[model samples]
Target: MTKLLFLVADGMGDWPVAELGGRTPLEAAPTPNMDALARRCVAGTARTVPQGMAPGSDVANMSLMGFDPAAHHTGRGPIEAAAQGLELDPDDLVWRLNLVRVAGHGPGDAMLDYSSGHIDTGRSTPLVEDLQAHLGDAVFSFVPGIQYRHLLVQRGGARAPEAALDIRPPHDITGQPQGPDLERFASSPRLAELRRAAARRLEAPANTTQANAIWPWGQGRPLLLPAFRQTFGLRGAVVSAVDLVRGLGRASGMEVAEVPGATGLLDTNYQGKVDAALEFLARGGDFVFLHVEAPDECGHSGVTADKVEAVRRFDERIVGPVVRALQGEDAALLLTCDHFTPLARRTHTPDPVPFLLHHPRLADHALPAFSEAGAAATGLTLERGHDLLPHVLERLRG
Candidate 1:
């Protein structure tokens, strides 16, 4: 049986950091196994993010799953809604809600940390329950998610006049004045009051949490996609800690292997993910997508050292072990990031990301290590990232 493994380390592509002596985190990190893999694998670049699209995880990961984002993507919220197995009405609008920390109550106040210091689910979950208790009504309901992420459902909001309002993600506006974005939500009469009340409730003196407000963005109706097996002729599974990726797997009718303690942070259970993936493959599953989110979180924080350490850990913990485990198997391994979360920008960029593909029969490109520059040097560029997977499969069966 031909096995396929697609591994993603979120936000691994990055710009050169001055503090790292003009090397990006991926370049600065000593990933010995990845270096050896690149020297013996097909190296290339892929533009996972389409033109004029916001370089978000929802979009990029969709492309990586061999789905065309421009054709299939509805919005970030609905993808996450799928993760929770929410049965949304066709006209119900689902929004990706975040427990965020803002500087003050006024609209002029600067937006603060997006993840609210990555508040634990234990604390954030109760706060969402409070919102559901206080603000959830016939037209709206709140659903708690992991860490600082959550969801809000607006019944039949797809037909509402405010459905056209474009709410920005809190992470993208960190440290900037939030008046304009706040005004966008204010345009929604019902959501406006909900937002204000939620802020007040979260900021109550006794609350004493980093998250002072509930930020709702990325709203849309539910997403729909063709089954992965039907589309690719391969039964596949997804291993990830975040809802966005799990939601994508669910939407595509693939299995999701949930690993306990699989936080999308630095302390995530890397070994558990590796075990789950190998188990799936051993059980005759033709394909698997293994995703790690810690690097992306560090990218959002703009901490160079943290990002470097995260890349090293991914190499040492996830990639290293997986490669060793599959040494004698007839497996094709593909390693890449979904998009670039440039530390300089403190957000995602549409730049092309490096990819290394290792197949049983393919010759090595002889690159010293897997880096943005080494990939470019290969002179192979995939214009549509969604096509890369199918292309690899075709080559495998050739």
Candidate 2:
């Protein structure tokens, strides 16, 4: 049986930028390895984010992994909670509490930084501990996760209709005034109190560029889904640095492989992840999903050059090594992004992303490049992202 590799470069899609002379980051980057792979593969566009759904990584990744987001996605909170090993009851409501920075004390203050300047785990962990000590009670609890990303669980709160509060992701409103949203949350005396206390307690003297507030959003209950192996008839593993991906892997009954230096940043251990994926396949695994988040972070920060460099690194470090390792092997490789985190908007867009499917037994398509424009030029597109996985599997088995 042939092995399969599904590689996701998060937020790799981008709109044309004036700074790069009308070329998107993926097009502008010098990704010779990816371009070469395109020549020997079938390339096309796929809509990962379904209609009327928010363009979040949770939804897009679910679709990419062959799970229908409309049916499988509960929310991001439950996924991250699973990653932290926190079990949730049917009536429990979980929220993703992000350490964010606001400009002023008033409600009209702008959301200055969503990830609290991407604060290190060492500093953010203590702040979460302080919140747990001060704000946690019989009804609510705070659990520390990775840097800036944490969880807040309201036990049995899902039984209340009010638990379905309208919450916005802080990253979606960066540099925008939070007056309306803050005022709405403040209408609840309990939430207001927690917000005020968190602001005061998070103020550390050593923290100059860190967060002073906790922005909670993406609330939902736990989800139960069929195992990946059961659904696809292939034992697989997931290699990613982000908790969301790992949690999805866990929930889908796939092994989650953690790399030592996989920080989900530009400095993440690319070689470590590559090694892990190849090792899993060598050890009788039928499939492996590898994800990288550096391009997404760069898109969120609106850094054009960094986004370009990130794509280059992904091609050189991850894709190149994996291709070289599988030179004499019977394996298949699928490369694509979940969604478009355009630098122009500094947020995710519900746009189709390019995908390349390469297999050693397949004939070369002789494509010119592996990019948005290049894929669009092919005029081949997959209307639904979930269909791509099954199609790849069918082709691989053939």
Runs of candidate 1 exceeding 4 Å displacement: none
Against the reference, the lDDT scores of all candidates come to: 0.91, 0.88
Residues 125-215, model 1: lDDT tens digits: 9899998998899999999999998999999988986568888888899899889988887777788899899987887776767999888
Distance from true position, residue 316, model 1, in Å? 0.4
Range of the 10 consecutive residues with the lowest summed lDDT in candidate 2: 359-368
Global lDDT for candidate 2? 0.88
Compared to the true structure, candidate 2 yields what TM-score?
Answer: 0.97
Please estimate how well model 1 matches the true structure, expressed as its whole-model Cα lDDT.
0.91
Clashing pairs in 1: none
Question: Of the candidates shown, which would achieve the greatest TM-score relative to the real structure?
Answer: 1
lDDT tens readout by residue for model 2, 43-138: 788999989999999989988899998888888998888777787899998888999989976877899999998998888888888789988998
RMSD of each: 1.0, 1.4
